[model samples]
Target: MQSSYLLTLLLFAVNAFAVSLPIRIVSWNVRFDADASTRQDGEKPWSTILCGIWSERCRKPHVIELLKNEAANTASPTIIGLQEVLDNQLEDIKGGLGSTWQHIGFGRDDGKKAGEYSPILYNTDALTLVFSEMKWLSPTPDEVSFGWGAGSRRVVTIGVFEHKATGKRFIHANTHLDNVSSEARSEGIKVVASRIKAVREQFGPLGATLTGDFNSEPNQDAYQTLEDMDFLTEVSKSEAVKIRNLDLTYTGFESEAGFSRIDFVWFGPTEQHFYAAQSWEVVNNVVDGVFISDHRLVVADLTAL
Candidate 1:
């Protein structure tokens, strides 16, 4: 009789500890490392470049404000995966985000500070970083080099975090696959999948969320490669979730077309594990008729049950 009572008490205790936690994750491509002196096609010299600097500055404040709002509203700290970030832009964003925000990533060009970055940012007060890495999307992933006919040396940033309150850990990976090379996109995705699986295997039953600008549409092979993985599901397509602003992610100053829905947030571990998107949004990032980013932001309100 005493053993039965003890068993009942233990079950209750376990049930009490099984509380679900909500985490807000965002993925954005914030243009790139272009300054006022940069050049472009089909425009007067220094005209388009000067306008780009002004437009980016206008959008910077809005992006900072949105991050602050998200941090304030969520119980768990918000995780942001940013692509097309330059070293200067990263510092500027960190300053705007305040001291509590921390990030992990490196430039893909020289592996120091030459090229674009795919950085993952998180609030230090709500989470602790366990492990982080940056790898090139090439046949020789360990070194900074391009492969598979890639136009540039693309990279992926990954971080494993432990929730401060719940004692739960999860992996967050970020990347921007090559836009020009079809071979690079397909092979790059396979590498990402293998890396995600390897991380989970080493860490034990932990769920993972990968967010990025894949540069591929739903019908493309790169997108299909992800769907065939059988573990990852598009957060926007999840049942009971809301999808907003279902238009093109890349505006290219309204010149580019057919590149809709390239930015995405995918949730993995679809088995018995706890992962679901309650709501999703492709944030309308234009402010006062000026686009903040060439690529719109994608956000997901997720719950780990």
Candidate 2:
């Protein structure tokens, strides 16, 4: 009888722990130069690397399918923060994922005339957008310069969402730091940390998640700055979860040696509400020996804290 009582207490504890949270998040940086059709237009490559010849065949369907598969695999993320997506590309992603997601973002680089922008997509049924803003990472502020002396331009998009059912609020920030200039990357990290600090101070304690493709590796100064700021905890390092795809996410076409695990997802003080987090690279969508993007999708799951 004592053993039965102890077992019942343990089960109750597990159930109580599970009901404490109410949100899940997914974050990724889809490579900018994924479209082959744009190559023929004589436009400069969005990526830092050399973009090969354009393929006449469309890879959008395959790319969309992979995104859908990622979403389907998760326990229904309440919010998804994405970077490197074009204005029209969001439509494609929404179409692929069906009616469950609604998105918000602005063209931070010259009103969408050039360069890629970061965007956030959320499950409409789970969360409602309360506020959103876009800002540049360079000295020019509104200009399109790749602030970190990077070979490409980058921006950060932030969204505040309110849970429709629980009324709980959380902020999500998404960005792609400079890939070329070490200085720019460092400056970008500082900018992000400052902004998050300011947000928390003004808005009070709330759950927050920052997701993006930070270009630099884990041990780099850029990543270390953010870590020291107490702004976030790297989900990849969590003890409760074991995420796969630990190698290079950047696959250079058919090149076997090409890979870099530069993508990441992070959480702030309210992160304890989440139960799990992870990342994945869609390696199966290669077409004729070429990959859908140079980078893979990084995903994470959170319950609530």
Candidate 3:
């Protein structure tokens, strides 16, 4: 009888040690232009025009449904890093997502003067925020202006969280890079790469993940710069060809033949154990059969190192 009890305890211990630490993350640029007009009444005309573009192009109801679907499909992700989300939209998402998900974000565009921002949302039940901060990509971190004229303004949101159950901690960095100028994109990549390196240096290797709509494709030079820095692993490259062949994430308003794979989820090289990286296009609704938001949500599952 004693032998049976000992054997059972041994098995339980082994099972506990062998269990995989699974984390699901979703990155989406919700089209910042959509909420531009929601500012105080009589906001700037430029902001109104931006909001109008968003309303016409972005399907908020469909997006909320997509978020709910992702949460349900994954049984809820520990962390969700989002870009181009305005303050008002974050509130709407909170209402829709219920009290389970907690979020942190700040606007890089106009700062407190205006209310736009990018937010990182996480399941409060699974992870607790340890630290959070927002910083610009410009050489001058204190400035609020568009870092390099890379479309309005941009900023990166960083958060460190501890797994409520296992006590394991990891950092998640989210950002939206310049979409227009190659120089801006290149500079933005360096700034973010430097930030990631600094985090790993302080937190130890393999202790972080970076996700966002970088606005640069896998084959682009900006992405290559990151690869050279050894700061991130483009999940798609490690994934199988069959999986990589899926439709690209960004479709310019109208359905066109060529779409770019600009959205990405990257992990440091130290995180090699987490393999078989993959991405999916969450195509739910279409206008006249044309997709919404020039971009799609890309997700990947990784085995903890």
Candidate 4:
């Protein structure tokens, strides 16, 4: 009996000696709720057109429930990077996620409550927010404006977090690249990559993880541009592709046949990676016969090295 007790204590001691606890980071692009006249095929409005006749409550609940269930799946701390979130939708999600959740990022339009936000949501009980900032995906990143012939303004939200369990610090940046111009998508990721250097200069070599909808595929210019940066490595392209994802992250609503793989979860400074990828999952978008979002969420489990 003493031998068994000693073995259990040894295991716990080893785990406690680790630098940082394992964390789950989720990246998703929830489709925006378009105007009544602008709704596309297979795309459903967030609210019901006919309130009483609709079978389910609304699209909002499924999205809320999805995050809630995802958070409950593991005891480890969780943080999420989301794209295509409007001001009102942010309010809905924050309220639905309850008091334990907090986020860092603002709307992309006026830098307040105007447009879409590539927000990073974190669990307050597990991590402390050290610093947070939102920057445009432009040569002049400090200004909130369009760049590289992009139709709309794009932005990235970067946050430094301290793991409460281990007292270690790391960075998380989130963004949504342009879907219209390939040039914009290409330049946008470069700006996001540059933030890595800026972050290191200020924070001094903390590991950085980025989650976003690149819009560019693995073969595209933007993905290649970021790859050439060399320090920030994509997890899916690495040997850590331990578990195969059944479907691509972007579903495009009801189309079961043609989803694209645009969403990504990445960890960096390849030489001194803080979080090593353990497993990857492209979570299903559909629930109870309803699609939660046009794009499915991607979750990655990262363990401290």
Candidate 5:
């Protein structure tokens, strides 16, 4: 009788633990909508690197499949932040993923359909979108104008989500900084931090995750600004790399190892929420010689404490 009672207690504990699973958030730059028909000058030489011989338009299907698998594996559905996505590409992603998935964000050009978008996609079944907004990385963030030394208009997509089963809430922000201007990249992060703080103030204490393709290296001023703030921490710092492969995030379809690690998945305001960094991976989605994007998706698994 005592053994039976002990078994029941153990089972209950296990079940309780299983109910509180960590959320999986992914950050990927889908390389925009540059297919065969729309191939530019730079992509011409790299045509041979694709999976299907002379097939430059098949990456969307692979990307969709990868996202589907991510959603299937996690108990607490996956939230994806995508950059460099055009309007048509967004439609393709949404159609491929089905109605269960929904996204929030707008075009950077006019907040409509002019420029690329840095959008966030969530599983509607597992998460409820409480609030969402888009802010530009400019001095006058409210207006659709570029600031600092930006070459083009850049914006950040912010979403506050609540877990359907657990009622747990968190904030997710995604962006892509200016590629050419160092001033833009540096000032852009500061703007992001301010926005994150504002959202936290409005939504109460919530764990935050910021993901993006910064287009700057770790040692640059932009990264240093984030470090100096001491609020956010890169997820890659905690994980022990299994394979010391090319750390570059932007491969550009070349075999060269000189590319910088520009992509990142960050979680923090560590003092507010205890974040246990689980694993970090630079997913090489180049299957059978086909590349998913020029940039590898940087995925991190984290548990909020």
Candidate 6:
């Protein structure tokens, strides 16, 4: 489906004098770089360069370009949470975003370089890492294991960050709920929320943001359960909030393949927290001709309350 961008940022740009309480957050599930045999019709294998060194058919360059543009507005310090990222793809993103960007979280399978990472990337010039950790979404969260009949191991990357400019701190947690098991998705998010609360008890009272490809819609168990959570405030789904679009976030590569809203960004443990979402937008996933990822990323501006 079609989409638009943030008019708030545009106004910030044109007027230079616009009040900028710019703490921008993004949630995306960049489809894992897969083997050609498994590649679908609308999908392209990832590449690091342009052709001889990089080919036009490659998707990594495009992915990097999309991120670069997203992080372009420096006045708003950006924090990006990405899912389905292989270790190599993470490196490509780091390199593309350059030295000013830094990230946290390790692979879920081995806690090393073995599996996918739902990593949190931020601009170093804007934010300082206070604390971070990665935990499996299983009963044995401290160990590498699967949970609730899930097909594979899943993990949540949690980080506490301080805005260098204002000394404001916020917690950000990122994860991808399992697609194969409804029980896993449902139980896994409770694990995620408990972890965030644990973080808050240790370092909060400060505002917190959770970004992820939940794989479950608002009416579904996972999303609804999280909303039922007293500590968290749903931004993208809240009727009280004026969001630019509640459009489907996952396009499944082809327009006709699949359409759904399974991604979200939230703030908590109470709406009274310092971070109040100001503007929210579901960014267009298509760049030029290729879908940047199977899902459209969500962007939001938060004011420090």
The runs of at least 3 residues in candidate 5 whose Cα sits more than 4 Å from the true structure, single-residue gaps closed, are 1-21, 35-57, 239-246, 256-258
Q: What is the TM-score of each candidate against the true structure?
A: 0.86, 0.77, 0.78, 0.89, 0.85, 0.88
Off by over 4 Å in 2: 1-19, 33-56, 112-114, 140-148, 256-258, 270-290
Model 4 C-alpha lDDT per residue in residues 93-207, reported as the tens digit of each score: 8898989889999989999988999999998898999999999998888888997988889999999888777666788999999988899999999889888779878987778
Better of 3 and 6 by lDDT: 6
For model 1, state the Cα shift of residue 97 in Å. Answer: 0.6
- Counted clashes in each candidate structure: 0, 6, 0, 0, 1, 6
lDDT for each residue of candidate 1 in 1-305, tens digit (9 for 90 to 100): 99999998777645533766688889999877565476233112211334445644355665666666766776766999999888877887888888988999999998888899999999888889988888888889889899699988888888888877766778889989998899999899888877878887887667789999999988897888888877788786676367654566776544434257899888867665568678887776565565566777888888876
With a 3 Å backbone cut-off (N, CA, C), the pairs that clash in candidate 6 are 49-54, 50-54, 50-55, 51-54, 51-55, 231-269
| Best candidate according to TM-score | 4
RMSD of each: 5.1, 8.5, 6.7, 6.2, 6.7, 9.4
lDDT per residue for candidate 5 within 31-150, as digits (tens), equals 877657876434432223463554443576677777777667667568899999889878878877889889999999999887899999988988899999999999989889897888
lDDT of each: 0.78, 0.65, 0.65, 0.83, 0.79, 0.82
- Predicted structure 2: lDDT: 0.65
Q: Report the poorest 10 consecutive residues by lDDT, candidate 3.
A: 39-48
Q: Report the alpha-carbon TM-score of model 2 versus the true structure.
A: 0.77
lDDT-better candidate, 4 vs 6: 4
Whole-model lDDT for model 5 versus the true structure?
Answer: 0.79
The digit string of per-residue lDDT tens for model 6 on 1-305 reads: 12235776455444432233557788989899989898777887876445336445777887788788878954688889999999999999999999999999988889998889999999898889999988899898999999999988999999998776656677899999999999999899999998988988998476788899998988998998898877777775443345555478999778834489898888766756456567777878776677768888887777655
lDDT winner: 4
